[model samples]
Target: MDGPGHGDAALSAPTLTAREAGLVGCRQCTRVCEAADERCPRCGARLSSRDPGALQRVWAWWLAGALLFIPANTYPMLITSTVGRASEATIVGGVIELLHYGSYGVAGIVFFASVMIPVGKFVAIAYLAILVQRGHRTKPKHLLHLFEFVEWIGRWSMIDVFVVAILVALVQFDLIATINPGIAAVCFALSVVFTMLSALSFDSRAIWDRIKTLSND
Candidate 1:
């Protein structure tokens, strides 16, 4: 039999994972450390190759967010009271009203941020969580990119809450008209917060681990 050569081993060398190399990456700071270390030196955060309860936490928060999203859409987001008239408008209703008033730009923005973005985030988070849990190795890089995109866009999802706050503050008139945030504002804000928590609780390293497994195979 021919002796093992450099070319034969070279192909497998590049796929060696950090754990196999006797190293672990800090989850908080992304610093490489000896696997024996219990804590990250730089950030003082606990060191773990992967979060033990990541999927559980992600699922819990995701469920809460999904539940709250219902009321956020059904209940009124803004209550407008004038001298003798009153009206309640949910997020979609407010967007429609803005469109009817010919403020197309604002209407589109509200619809995109309030309706489209939140729904998209819920779906994306759930998808990422499921993929990571299943250890599905296909398109690992693309999945990581999707997770990062989800985290990056999370803050912007609060645009609706910000709009409600601004209107409540600036559109107050004692006798003429007043705009007040409704129950949906709280529900929507809570839903956004829970979804954000879910995204953060996910361990992106899980995606890479699956990639590493495939490469080794």
Candidate 2:
């Protein structure tokens, strides 16, 4: 009733080839086949997992982007001018202005889509990366839940980009309420994109696999 040993022969072990080795435990969910489902008993990938370094790289980008995002949100992202006089607005300031002007919908949307979501994504992704780097079994299940949340919120963090795009494209009426996106917008946009890429590139199975191997060793 016991399983085959690690290198034991005559047991017909499910060995993976070179290329397929990296994709060892990744199998269909059998219910809904998506980009996920790293474990599959039917596919014999249950023991095979992912690359541990992948999680470390993901965290590097995430933590760095989070650092950049702090300033991006704090600094002025838009400068508006009329009669050669200008007013600057950080993200929070812009939100408040919108609310003051009775643009509650715009303000609410900006606050959630841009401010809250980006910050939340950074924090969540960083935490997951840290957990994986620990490389120990009995891992926090909530980290997986947080990872799911990070994936779900990743795309929505591009609201700042959309806002900038719209402003640069539509607000071309010079001599009126002109809008020029500042340095902060570019940095913020890049932070969101890079963090998103980092999260997607990460492989959680790799972390767990390394942990399992080390623990076995």
Candidate 3:
């Protein structure tokens, strides 16, 4: 009784074509339908796109990297001391030293790159991964684009770690100044590296694959 032809005189329903019924959906978005169809069954937009499994792998790596982040921050990342000094300085101590010397900008940048950036990237990547895994359809395209930006920027997280490494390697004076890396530093660096790798491993194009395949099936 609710066939396509049973609509009211003023309101018309979409016509289902054989080709459309057999066409695959895009895995990314549920907005697309076959070209032959007048109305999209999922999204009301004019049929003009494909959905694919574009977010699966990327999100997978993101989650893994996120997990690694917890331990990375919990461990010590750097050690510093004057060659005969009684006290050793860690990452936080280094920042405090810079701040005490009135190097606010340097302190800010160092802390941001070493502490803020990596942690932020992990949290963001995890969120995106979870969203994709849940097959959340209400997301805006900008979110994916935002993910691209985040991944791109995440690589810079190594800047602080590398700088610290260089400092440790270069500033070794018997009774002057010495720098050393801490356990947390290594773990944090590894976490950044893996997170960056995870971001790269992800294939954003697969999201559309899901929509295209499922819709037509």
Candidate 4:
């Protein structure tokens, strides 16, 4: 009566993947197609069971983003000129200055958007890449969720850059007071763009494929 239908036994069974079922999914449209199909009918996208170059591209972009991020933190993000005197502020410096002025809420927002989020994304993407490379011993579903989270938050990391651009455009007052974006702005923007490319280049199906390979062994 309580044989194969047992709770733990059933739960421990490996999840079946589309690849195992001889299916390929369109990355753009999420349409399931026969593995033999060259393209997805719904989206006209090339169909592949797994992206052969996904990890390579992910690491390449991730490295470019990480390298640029170092200079982004070290250099000034915004240069402010007031009464012909110039003062530069980096990302962390801006947050500290905000807090110094008792703008606690704004400071927190800036810190989260500029500091914590980017670091979190870097760590998350690297972890996902490592997991996939190591054959994904962890739950593929969880890995996929983490990848999705990284992708979702990737765009928001540019909040600081956007803020700098807005301030630079609106605060120009020639000699009295002017705000200009600094070198760090360019670095940070490029870093954000590269990291976004890293996330986009990742193939979530690779996670499932690795999981299936492990289960078969």
Tens digits of per-residue lDDT for model 4, 57-169? 99999999999999999999999999979999999999999999999999999999888988999999999998888886787668878888899998998999999989999
lDDT of 2 by residue, 1-217 (tens): 3555666555563554322443333434422222244555455454323454676678778877888888888788888886678889888888898999999998998899877888778767766666566565656455566777787787886786678778877776787767888888888888888888888867745544545666777
TM-scores of the models, in the order given: 0.88, 0.69, 0.62, 0.88
Model 3 agreement with the true structure over 101-200: per-residue lDDT tens digits: 9999999987887678777777776666665555555344665786788778887778767877788789888678777777766666777777887776
Ranking by TM-score: 4, 1, 2, 3
Flag clash pairs in model 4: none
How many residue pairs clash in each candidate at the backbone level?
Answer: 0, 4, 41, 0
Error of 3 at 170 (Å): 2.4
Model 4: residues with Cα > 4 Å off, grouped in runs? 1-16
| Candidate 1 per-residue lDDT over residues 1-217, each given as its tens digit | 3345545743444566677788987767878788888988888888876667988999999999999999999999999999969899999999999999999999998898888878888899888877766667678779888889989887787999999999999988988999999999999999999989999888887887766666777
Please list the residue runs of candidate 3 whose C-alpha ends up more than 4 Å from where it truly belongs after superposition: 1-64, 207-217
How many pairs of residues collide in model 3? 41
Model 1 clashing residue pairs (backbone): none
Model 2: CA > 4 A from native: 1-49, 135-141, 206-217
Q: Which candidate, 2 or 4, has the higher lDDT?
A: 4
User: In candidate 2, where is summed lDDT lowest over 10 consecutive residues?
Assistant: 26-35
